[model samples]
Target chain A: MPAVHAEGLFKVFGRRPADAVRRLQDGASVADVRESGATPAVIDAGFSVEPGEIFVVMGLSGSGKSTLLRMLNGLLETTAGTVRVGDAELTALDAPALRRLRQERMSMVFQHFALFPHRSVLDNAAYALEVRGVDRATRRAKAREALALVGLDQWADQKPGQLSGGMKQRVGLARALAADTDLLLMDEAFSALDPLIRREMQDQLLELQASLGKTIVFITHDLNEAMRLGDRIAIMRDGRIVQIGTPDQILETPADDYVRQFLADVDRGRVFTAGHVMVPAPALVAPTAAPAQVLQTMRDTRAGSVLVGDGDGRVVGVATEDVVRTAVAAGASSLAGLPLLPAVDVRATTPLNDLLAAAAQDEVPVTVVDDDGRLAGVVPRGAVLAALGGVPRPAAQPPVALAEAEAVPPADETALITSGGIRG
Target chain B: MAESSDDSGLLPRIPVGEWVDTAFDWVTENFEPVLDAISTASGAGVDGLTDALLLPPAILLAALLALLGGVLRSVRFGIASLVGLLLLISMEMWEPAMQTLALILVATVIAVAIGIPVGIAAAKSSRVSAVVRPVLDFMQTMPALVYLIPAVTFFGIGVVSGVVMTIIFALPPGVRLTELGIRQVDGELVEAGHAFGSPPGKILRGVQLPLALPTIMAGVNQVIMLALSMAVIAGFVGAGGLGGLVVTSLSRLDLGLGVEAGLAVVILAIYLDRLTSAFGQQRRGFPSFLSRGGTVTTTAAASSRSVDAPVTGATDQNARPEPAR
Candidate 1:
């Protein structure tokens, strides 16, 4: 049996009694929601969740992604159509049976981290177990174990408010873990965090999923988030599943215009890697090569930048045509003194947001490096944007609005780094 | 010796002697004056109290809140609420009713002003909440009568003491709910706020407050009802108006008068509750402004304890969210 199955679900809400009923009764596709009293929120939507797959329901607000997620646990009953969790038909189950199913078989981590504020982190995490009538000591021990799994072992006595955004989410995950459920539902769990924090959480989730192997249904509207986290994503539109497929398959092929448009604005720069960038590392570099030689080498190699190595086979300098003229004209004394952006190689472990921030704003392409400072390859700014869902490279040097997003410039950075300031 | 100290620490030891001593001191300081104020107000006619003299203001307030409620929900609900107020007046219950309304309004205002900030504090600081939690629990469970003694002692009867006790009784919902609202606020919005480099205060004021307004307003609504409930109790001390009237009628066993006054109180309660709820529902600043649907199933899921029960229990489908049917 499928883990979660919704067969032709229908939920309508509106005013104007007769008309609203007519829409639902007549099966008018795409009922004019604005009209009459009853607005059908979800209509004839159907889907099935297979075991052990990280199934993602992706949709913007009002598409009923959250409603769909809630229906799985019987937090909400479908207006029309049958819902089944595992082999048990949810529509047929009584409230107590549903609660038992939710408590024993599945756990939900709300988007808001709905950990009880009155309880300590341990108690909050262990609440599901406590509700299940587990002994306090055993429940607490389980909570501690779960908290450790989420890397929040030390914050046991603290409340949800005391923890950071990512930490609170960890507690939410810990609560689900303590429930000892086979299935976990995450409703935009990390969407409420800072971008950097969000990235870390995604990586953490991926790592956790790999370890726990819990059958998870993750809901998110952010296409990039969906692409990164989902084993298979179900793109939802107007309370219906448009398509379901893996990231690579979805990226190369979208189901419809809605999916395509969403994919268009995605930031792919961080997702792409040096494997896509490397041509072949050059064995030699001429010390006295003219600008023409460097230009020829770059073109022949199809490299965004060329590394200038010494006799010891260590990279001493690098040259990119975009800014090489300044370096060349400045002479070795001044040039070598100023470290070039292309020469500094970043590791694979580097997050995209950080990599973008560290990379120079100019036409410099960032180089990728392995553990030993050996050049792996390079990732251009364009590639980061591509990997991130091909979001338009904003006109601003920084991908974000610096004044608003990077506003207040962390007291330390504000003191030292002074560059091209956005003139108001 | 250490074991004895530890053993002593584990005892449920409240001093009846000390309680009696304080209680005696409190009664002498308050009981007489509260009695005096009541006799004085009754002799001076009900108009001498806050309501009759403040009739225009009371009606004006009702009108304004009712109008706002109308815009939020429907004109009919607003009009019906106004009529509810009119019934209180037609029963010749105007002065006492108004006094009761005034005390409730004042108490609720103070409760909101103080409660919301403390609630926000609780939401932000678990340590602070841990400290405040037991205090709030005590405030909640200590009984309205128990709180009245302190309220009378501190504020010394009449409107002041009445308002004080009302605040004590009603303050919890405001704070607890503010904390709840803040807690329940969508994480996405908070993150979006943070992503904008918004400080904690800004995120709270701009994002969390607006989104949580529905729940916070629900708290405010609870606070209002609690304040009203405290009104009759407030009468036992020095609070003037309908509560005083009830005490008078109940004392004489004036069946006609007692039932009439009681009915007036219910009318006032209905008017206020409806008006406040409608206003809460109609909040335009609320992100969705979708009056909580009249759905049986709220965000709350039923526990495994019951299944045959209609998922949406018939305790009138959570009045907080129910749209006008």
Candidate 2:
């Protein structure tokens, strides 16, 4: 069962909300509300959130994202349609029921940190519980646990004024957590913060969500942030849901022009990791070595490159099966007789975005390796594109040349700079 | 019966028209003496002045000093005090100005005593604002002269009457502005109270009142200045300060006394204006310390010191973006 379900949710602010909503049902959009001289804030929106899942709603300002959030808690009574939290219909609940739900089932973290400047960090976190008349001892213990969860236990007594912006937001999160609600609603909670602080808070929420498993509905305008945190994202435009899908699905196939433009220049490779997609290396003996030994190493590790050790077990060279074929095709040296060529190696720990540019500019396949720098596998250009939710096209289509190929590496450059296609 | 034929015989050529014209000429010639005998009015008198001087001077002093302190609080307006001194000396009305100053001081003390509590009550209760709002409206719109008639009717025309009228005329702004200041306090701060599960009244005491005070005090400053202006007008009803001197001089057609007394009023007005204005600046000039009625008088404020501290941490250190709620 859905943790929260909102069906045909509508909010129209005007002297005649009913009339305006009727007009909306008759095919008048939010714009028509103005054309007919009324204010229609939310119109015909619908979505369901599963328990223990992170659902993100993304939109630019005035796209009704904030209004939709307000409606979830009955801060605004909807003009039309029904909303339910679990089996309890939120729209039908009276004030007391709604307040009970807010205190016990749904805890909200507002964008402004909403930390009381006068209260100590501990007290701010414990506010929601206190409002519900949770006994002081239980509230304090829970608040401390929540604070420690956010790594703010040390600063419990510090007032918001004394705390940093990020710390204050952590306190806000702790407050929400201390409520021990089933659903945590965050309304662009980090938008007011600076970028670096924003990133930190995002990580904290993700961490908290993983361990706590509370059903979460996070609202944000930044698509990258949505991609980072959302289990599923619903894009909103002009009071309407444009598209809703998993991040990969949305990135790969945007619903329409609006979304395509929104995702343009969106660096997908940053979100993709080598662990998800890498071609397993094929193993065989160099003509000079035993095939059995090569087969043993290849069976042990399914990576793309094999290391050739000297008589002293020191690495002499590395072999990637794809690279051997390429060298033979280029007629540089036949793979049949030439010792395995060590092209270039990178660790799996390196971020994928960097690998894209470096491999492309060098016009060579990069070898993936263990932390000890031993060759483990190789990642060709095709694997990078495939991991990015883009299907690898047929062999006839040449790989798109990496941008750095047209230019020479500057003298004072690191290998990652030349190899990694770090999208700006 | 005998005249008509007799007149014709006596003057043979004199007409009746000639007789009527001569009679109207006689009346016009005698018009001034007739009017002088009919109704009368007084030109100007010393009694009004004497009555004005007999009133109390304390209220006048309160108004004057509040203005003076308010203005002197701002160094940018340094010329006001010197200019006020010059005006007083040139008009030769120094003694009356001092008396007015004394009265203004006393009135301000009374206003503060009464207005702040009323403001606090209004801030705490909506019902209070409802009751106070209309009263404030009435107080603001009622004419200053009208206040004097009631003062005289109730208090019998003295310095006490002047104080009563000035307070009546000036008190509303204090109440209205104080309430406004309190209500405008950030809602977030109020919610903090809920977080503590503190009563609304307690929240008001701890959070709302302290933040609202600077603005309310500003309102008080305005009330004092207004009250000073009304104090002089109260002179007409026998509430004396420097107001009496001006009224007396005007009565005697002594331009010298009139000018000097007017100058004296201006001096007191300036001093009150400066002092009240200075206090207001000190409120907004720096980030005032958030002391809850703790007598937060910080001199030589540290201007524009860094209020923002950097958040330093590992990758997530700067995370202050309002998280989605």
Candidate 3:
């Protein structure tokens, strides 16, 4: 079963909420409900979070993303429909039962770090466990471990008032982790930090999620953040979800003009990976293939280069037409013996932004390799440039390239072939 | 009809004073048992506290108070307490000073005990807040002396009557500030408590109470100041203290005694004010013995030595980003 399944959820605020919900369910619009004096904060919202998935809800302020999250956790009761978390129907649970569910099964991290100023950092991290009635020694040990995960074990004795905004937010994350729940709901958990700190936090959360594998429903107004973190993102607008898709899918085929307009601000290079733009390997030849046969295959495909894979299907290197012709003239038996061009190979998950220099310098496309160095696909220089230019910049904001290029580390020569082309 | 319309012959006189007298008489006649029990209990409480305070040698008490003030507040306030207490002793007002202190202390403790829960309730519910607002207004706006009439009638002329009047006059700020404090706590923090599955009671105890304590302490300070002023007024009802001494000195035209008694009241006010306000300003992480309450204080230190400089340093450490790895 999916970890969380919410269906037909509606939360109306102001007077006569039930009646407003009835009107909403009867096909009245959010504006219509507002005109009638009851504000429809969330309207017929529904989705499921798969186990170990980062399901992000993305929207601007007042889009009811937060309201929908609260409904899933049973903090705000649904006026219209149901929410099932695991096997339990969360909408059916009473207040005490919901509290028990929140205690044992789900935990939340807040936007402003919501840490108690009076509590020590360790105590703040241990708060959720304390509320669960865990024994002090066990809870403290667990809290220390969680703080260590966030690299804050040394500051455990200090109060949160002494910590900076980033450190305070680490305490918030630690509190959620210490709960040891399978499900975590984070409402803009990184939005309060400075941009550099925000990116660092995003990297940390991704690294943490890799090992912990908790099901998380993260909420954010920043589409770029949603794109980076979400395995599948749901776009919300005016109390309704307008689209649900993976990052690449949303970029390639936005559901409506609203999503397209929102995507205008996204730096596509950081979000789109090699896997997103790579085409099938151009021409493949076994490493033992005769140089004559390699030349014949490259001519048949009208390709400039061909990938040479060994018995394991892992690309050894690329052989260009000139290299193959030279090898043929020199009477080499197999393409493996020929001097091959240095085609930079990268894992499919490498961000397109990281491949810019490699793609710009090499004549051959960047090879996409799987975990065992097996051939996957190839991202060409043109594909990388096309992907980066897919979205236009918003007129008022500066272009993202200048700042982002500065953020890239000095190129690593082994992984990136920045100077050479086809070795003549 | 024309005569009635004129200012001098407006209408039949309303018997507001008589009606109030009748109301007081009815309460006195009907609720005598409950009133008597309260009077006896509070009277004994005041007597026990006054005797205990007086039992300590004045010099010993002064030193102990000075040490407490020094450790909990700052060294400067501590020295001030020592000097002020000695001056009160030199003027021969030590006994009456202790008497006034006991009265104010008892009244403040009682006022705070009852006021906080009411304030929490008011903060939680608009109905309770609406009902409390005007009653607090009336309690605060009424003259401090007017409370003495019912106080004397209810408990009879003594320290009990004085304590009762002081409680009434001092109660409003305690309630108001407590409510304001709880109400002013960040809404996101409360939402966070609920999101973490804390019940309402736990949220109130663990989250609301600690955050609201500074404001509540401010309220307690207000209560103490108002009680000191009102306790002196209660002396007109024959409740013996420095107020009685001042009244006697006034009657006899003895300027020296009046000045001494007035000076003693000032010393008591300043001491209590500083001590309670210090509780509101006390920072966390101090030795448990030095800390007054569990809450964290945001105010800087009053002394020139700058004991709180480390706290500002801690904040600055995280304010800037770490250098690139």
Candidate 4:
């Protein structure tokens, strides 16, 4: 089962919630519902999180992303629908049971770092555990461990008022960490910090996530942060989810004009992965294939190079046209003996910025490999340039030949890309 | 002329005064044991504190006051307290001053004990707050002398009645401020407590109360000041203290004795007022003292400057000293 599963969740804010929900289900607009004295904050919102993935809910303020996040943890009750954390239905739990769930199964970090000003850093960090009725010594020890994890053990005795904003936020993170729950709900947790501090905190959270792998439901208005931290992001608008996908998928193919507009300012070079821009190789040749056949296949596919893969699709090497032609003249029976050009291989997950850096040094298309070292596709220099320039490749031919695509002048490429034409 | 005409054409006046008179009589008759029990408890508390204050050697009490002043605030406040106590001693009104202090202390303790829980309840529920607000307003606005009539009617003439009346006069600020303070605690902090799964009671104790403390202490300070101001009025009902001396001296038109006793009262008021206000300031984490050019402006010094003007003028003029008669 997923760590968190929310289905058909609707939250209506006002009296006569049932009436409002009926109107919403009957396809009434949010404004229409409001006219009748009810406001729908979240409508039919649903999503599930895997056990250890960072699932981010992204939107502008008042978009119901926060409301959705709160519903997942039962902080805000759902007017209609069910939320299950692990196998337990949150909406079905009684107050005591729900509190126990919050105490033992999930914890939240707030935007303002809601720490008690009167409490010592150590005590504030240990608060959740204290609420859970953990014994004092054990709670303190655990809190100390969490504080050390966040690099704040030295400030344990100091009051929260004595800490800087970054340090106070760390205490908030430590409090959630100390609870040792399986799920973490972070509501715009880093938005209050200065930009530099915010970046540092994001980096710290990423590092912690790497080591801990806790299921996190992160809410933010920042698309950059959502892209950096989310394994999958759900983009919300006006109480409805417009799109949910990996950062690269969202950047490459936004679900609608709203999502596209929402992503207009995103730095695609950092967000789009090699997998997003990589085209399938023009051709794949076997090691035992005749050189004549290899050359024929490359010409038929209008390709500069072909990847040599084993029967199971593992990439052994690249075979260029020049090598194939030389092999054919040399009377080589198999293409394996040809002096193939060296090529850079990168994982499909490599960002376009890194792909551009790798592609800059290589003449041939860079090979993209899956997690298991199987050939996935190739990212040509043209594809990188086109993607970075925001130029849309032809729809009929998904993978453009590098030589043909490179014919565009660098100045036109710069103008076309800088004009943000990729949306087309 | 017809419209303006007569009392005979108007509605009959409700006999509210007679109803109140009968109600008080009925309560006094039936709840005599309960009333007596309250009087005994209040009397014991007042007498015990009065004896304790008066039994200590004059120098020892002054030293202790100075020490308390220094520890809670600053050495300047300590020295000021020392001078004030010495002035009381020099006026030969030490015992009467102690009795007045005792009455204020007893009334304040009782007021706080009853006030805070009521305040918390008022803060927690809108209905309770709505009910409590009008009651508090009535308690505060009713003439301080009105409390004496009912207090004496129930407990008869004694220190108990005086203390009871002082408590009624002083209780409103304690309750009102406590409610305001608790209500004013940041909503986010309370939400954080709830989000962490702390029970409501724990949230109140651990989160709400601690944050509200400085404001509540300010309320306690107000209560003490109001009680001190009522001490003189309490003496009208035969409660013996500096107020009694002022009353006796005023009847005889003995200006010298009355002036001395009134000066003693002013000194005591300033001392207690300075101490309690400094405590409130200290709780808020402001640096309570500053040393400058051989004059230390302690927290109390700042407050004393603000309060001294009207009080000193009024006391200097009225200067009614009660006698031991």
Candidate 5:
């Protein structure tokens, strides 16, 4: 079951909130709700977050993303809807029960790093546990461990005022982690940091998330951050979720003009990973296959080369037509005895921007590997160029030929590939 | 008679003063027992404190205060306290100074105990804040001497009445600032406290109170200053202290006695003001001898833990490889 689920959530603020929600339920516009002396902050919002997924909610200010998040934790009551975290119905829970659930099962990291200025860093980080009435010695030990995860154990004794903004934010993150809750709600957790610090914090969070496997609902206004961290992102506008999809899915087909406009400024090269563009490996030959058989597979597939894999499907190397012919002339019994060309391999998640240099140097298509270095797919030079082009190619269009794509002048190629457009 | 015959005034005179007098009389007649109980308890408490402060040798007490100044603030502040106290001693104002100190301390403690909770209530509820705002304004803006009338009626003429007047006069700022300080705390911090599943009381004590401490201390400083000023006015009703000397010197036009008493008040004010304000600043000034030892141990412990971090981080990463999701 999904760890957090919200169905048809409606949050209205000001006079006669229930009336406003009814008007909205009856298909009144947001403007109509506002005209009736109530502001509909979140209208008919619904989504579910799977356990261990980083579900990002991306929107500008006033989009009601923060309000939506507060409802999920029972911090703000919904005018109408249901929120379930695990087996507990958050909306149905009494105040004390909700607070208990918050204390024991969920925690939040705030944008401003809401650390107590008077308390030492360790005390601030341990505050959640403290409120839960955990004994002093044990809470402090847990807080110390959490701080160490953020590389800030040394600063635990210092006041929050003494730490820089990044370190203060780290303390806030540590505080949430110390609770050891299965779900984390981050409200622009890194938005207040400098650009360089923001990137570093993102990397640290991802690194920690890898082992923790905690379900995270991360909210941010930055599209690039959403794309980089989220497994699936929900794009919100005017208090409504317009679309929810993976990064490439959203890039390939935006739901509306607003979504398309939001995507206009996104760096596609950095957003699209090798896995998004890679095709199935054109031809495969087992390492123990004879040279004659390897050449036959390459010829049958109408490819320049074939990937040699061991029985376990781990990519061994590439055997080109030239190498296979030489090996056949030498009367090699098996291609494993022949010297194979070293294959340029990258993880499936390697961004297309990082693969450009590799794509340029290797004649054969770059190999995509999953965990255990097993062959997953191949990213040809043409595929990378096509994915980075100005207009997304139609799915039915065949993959562009490398020769035809390279025919464009180098300057035009750079313009087409980069977010910048082709020069007049 | 001719001016009265014209009879073209704005309106008849309002009997506000008469109404107030009648109200005081009614309260005095109806709550005599309760008022007497309060008077006796407070009078005993103030007297006990005064006797305790006077029990120590003047020189020993002066040294102790000076040492406290050094430890809580800086070495320079300590010497200043010592010099100021010695001057007061040489001027033969030590007894009265200690008495005034007793009064100020008791009044301040009572005011803070009442003020902070009310302030917190006002901060939490808009309705409470609305009701409190105007009442605080009236208390603060009224002439300080006016409180003495009701105080005198309730407690009779003595130090108890003086303490009561001082409390009424000094109480407004404490309440106002406490409310302001808690209200001024960052909204996000309060939300974080709530988000972490803390009950309201825990949030108030652990988050709101600690964050508002500096501001509340400022309020306490205001209270003490106001109490000292009002205590002098209380001298008119026969309360003893440096204020009594000033009143006596004023009646007799004795310049020497007046200067000595006024200067003693100044010295006390300067000492208390510096100490309380320093406490508010929290480790910004010269390091205190009392706190330095604590700092050294914490620093050592922190550094050792910091050193242990990278080693564990390295091993932890090696142990838990990134899972491909």
Candidate 6:
């Protein structure tokens, strides 16, 4: 079951919420509904978070991503629909029950860190447990453990006012970790930090997630952060979700003009991967094949080169037509002992920018291999250039080179080939 | 036609005086137990504190005052308190001054105990604030002399009446400052408390109250000052203290005695004001004892310099005029 399921959720901020919701259901614009005496902050939003997945809600300010997140935690009441966390329906729970659910199953980290100024760092971290009526010794021990997890144990006894901003945010993270809830809600938790610190925090959070695997609902206005951290990102605009997809899917096939414009400035080479842009190998020749057969296969396919695979279908090397011609002129019967040209082999998961140099240096397409070293597909130079240029490739003729690929000035090829790839 | 013209021309008189008299009469008749209970409690408190102050030897009381002043304010204030109290003793008014001090202390305690909860209620609800605002305005603006009549009618002329009148006159600042303090607590901090799942009461006690304490202490200082001023006025209702001494000296046309008693009150007021203000400042970690040169002598010198700087020009001008003459 999904860890959190929000269906048809609505949050209208002003008076006459029911009327606003009804008008929204009847397809009235948010501005029109607001004109009739209510402001719709979140309109008919619905999404389900799979267990142990990081689901990100991405939008500009006032697009209701935070409002939608607050509704999932029952911090804000939903006007029109239901939210289920695990087996319990949040909207149906009483105040105490809802508080108990929050205390037991969910924790949130805020953008401002929200450390109580009067409390010591240890006390701030232990607050959620204290609210749950846990004993002092146990809660303090747990809080110390959590502080240690965030690498802040030495500063436990100091007041929050004494800590730097990054340390304070770590204390906030420690507070949530000490609660040890199944679901974590982080609302722009790193947005207030400096850029260098924010990057460090992102790496720390990814490491924590790898080990903890807690289902997290992260809210961010930064699309780059969403792309880097989210397993699935839901893009919101004007109080409605416009698209939800993996980063590669969203980059390759945007849902609408809004998404298209949204992604226009994105560095597609870094986001797109070898698997996303690779074409299936034209033909595969076994090592035992005759040189004539290999040459004929290369001609039948595209006349550039053919991949030579072992009997188990793992790629051994590439056989170029020149090498085949050389072998046939020397009266070689079988191509098994004939030399093959060097080919650049990369994992299918390797990002496209990482293959730019190898693709530029070799005329043969870069080989994409799976875990077992079997040939999965080939990323042609034209496909890489097309993907980087943000041009859509035709479905049937995946290996066809774009005319723009040949138009590239020779002076810029080396610069383009060695451009910095995306940072993990 | 003439009668109608007269009625139209004459402005109708409001029976505000009669209404007020009747309201007081009704309260006096029905709430006698409440008044009696307050009188009895205040009488015991004043009598106990008065005995505690007066029964101590003159030297002991002076030393105690000096110690308190040194601890709360500066050592200069402490030495000044020692000299002031010795002067009061020499004038044979120490007992009356201590009685006055007792009256002010009891009144301040009662005022704060009642004021803070009302202020918290007002901070929590706009309706309560609306109701409280005008009532506080009325309490503050009414003549201090006007309260004596009601006090005399309710608890009759004594220390009880004096303390009651002082509480009434001093209560408004306590309420207003407490409400303002709570209202001014950072809204984001309050929201943080709420998001942590704390109930309203716990949030008020743990978060709001601690943050609001410095402002509330300011209110307490105001209450003490106002109560001291009113206690002197309560002398008209036969509440005997330094004010009664001044009143007697005035009746006898003895300017020397009146001047001495009045000077004693001024000394007490300055001492209390400095002490309370110092207490408020300490809440924010001021006057750090850990800092270098934070000894008693340095603090005393600093404080005296601040107080004496303004008088230097006047003294210099006076000296020049005398030399010219």
In terms of TM-score, the best-performing candidate is 3
Candidate 5 yields a Cα-based lDDT of: 0.82
* TM-scores of the models, in the order given: 0.44, 0.60, 0.87, 0.83, 0.84, 0.82
lDDT of 3 by residue, B95-136 (tens): 988888888888888988888888889999999999998998
Write candidate 4's Cα lDDT for B1-325 as tens digits: 7765676469687999899999999999999999999999999999999999978798899889888877667777788889888888888888999999999999999999999999999999999999998998787777777888898899989899999988887887788778888998888788778777788899999999998886777678777877887888888888889889888888999999899888888877767766776676565333544432123344445554444343333333222232111
Docking class of 1: incorrect
Fnat values, one per model, are 0.02, 0.10, 0.76, 0.59, 0.93, 0.24
Question: Candidate 5 residues A125-173, lDDT tens each?
Answer: 9999998899999999999999999999999999999999999999999
Per-candidate Cα lDDT values, in order, are 0.66, 0.65, 0.81, 0.81, 0.82, 0.79
Q: Residue-wise lDDT of candidate 6 within A110-221, one digit each (tens)? A: 8888788888999999988988889999999999999999999999999999999999999999999998998999988889999899989988998999999999999998
Ranking the candidates on TM-score from highest down gives 3, 5, 4, 6, 2, 1
DockQ of every candidate structure: 0.02, 0.09, 0.63, 0.59, 0.63, 0.36
Judged by whole-model lDDT over C-alpha atoms, candidate 1 comes out at 0.66
B1-325: candidate 1 lDDT, tens digit per residue:
9999998999878899698768877776667777566435433443344544474655676677566655555566567767766666567787787788777777788789999999999999899899888888777767678877766655566666776777787787788878877887766445423322234575576567876776777678677877787877788886878888888887799988888778877776766665565455444342222333223212221211132022113212222222222
Model 2 alpha-carbon drift over 4 Å, by segment: A86-88, A94-97, A118-123, A133-148, A152-159, A273-381, A389-424, B1-143, B150-164, B179-210, B228-232, B235-325
> Can you tell me the DockQ of model 5?
0.63
Q: Using DockQ as the measure, name the better of candidate 1 and candidate 6.
A: 6
Tens digit per residue, CA lDDT, model 2, A1-424: 9999999988887668899988889997666677766788777899999999899999999989988987887767889999899889989987667767776688888787777665688987888778788899999999999999999999998878998888888898898899898988888989989999999989888888888999999999999888888889999988888999987678766899998888865567765555333333323234454444433343344334444544332334655545544544555532344456655566664557867765574334565555554434446665676656456434543322222222323212322221222110
Q: Put down candidate 6 lDDT per residue, B1-325, tens digits, no spaces.
A: 9998898789687899999899999999999999899889999999999998888897898889877877666666678778888888888888889989999999999999999999999999999999999998787777678888888999998889999888887887788778888998887567656566667788899888887876777678777877777878878887788878877888999999889888878877777866775676464343533342266435644653443343223233211111110
Off by over 4 Å in 6: A252-255, A265-270, A281-367, A371-375, A397-424, B1-11, B72-93, B245-259, B281-287, B290-325
Model 1 spans with C-alpha error above 4 angstroms? A15-27, A268-424, B1-325
How would you order the candidates by DockQ, starting with the best? 3, 5, 4, 6, 2, 1
CAPRI level of candidate 4: medium
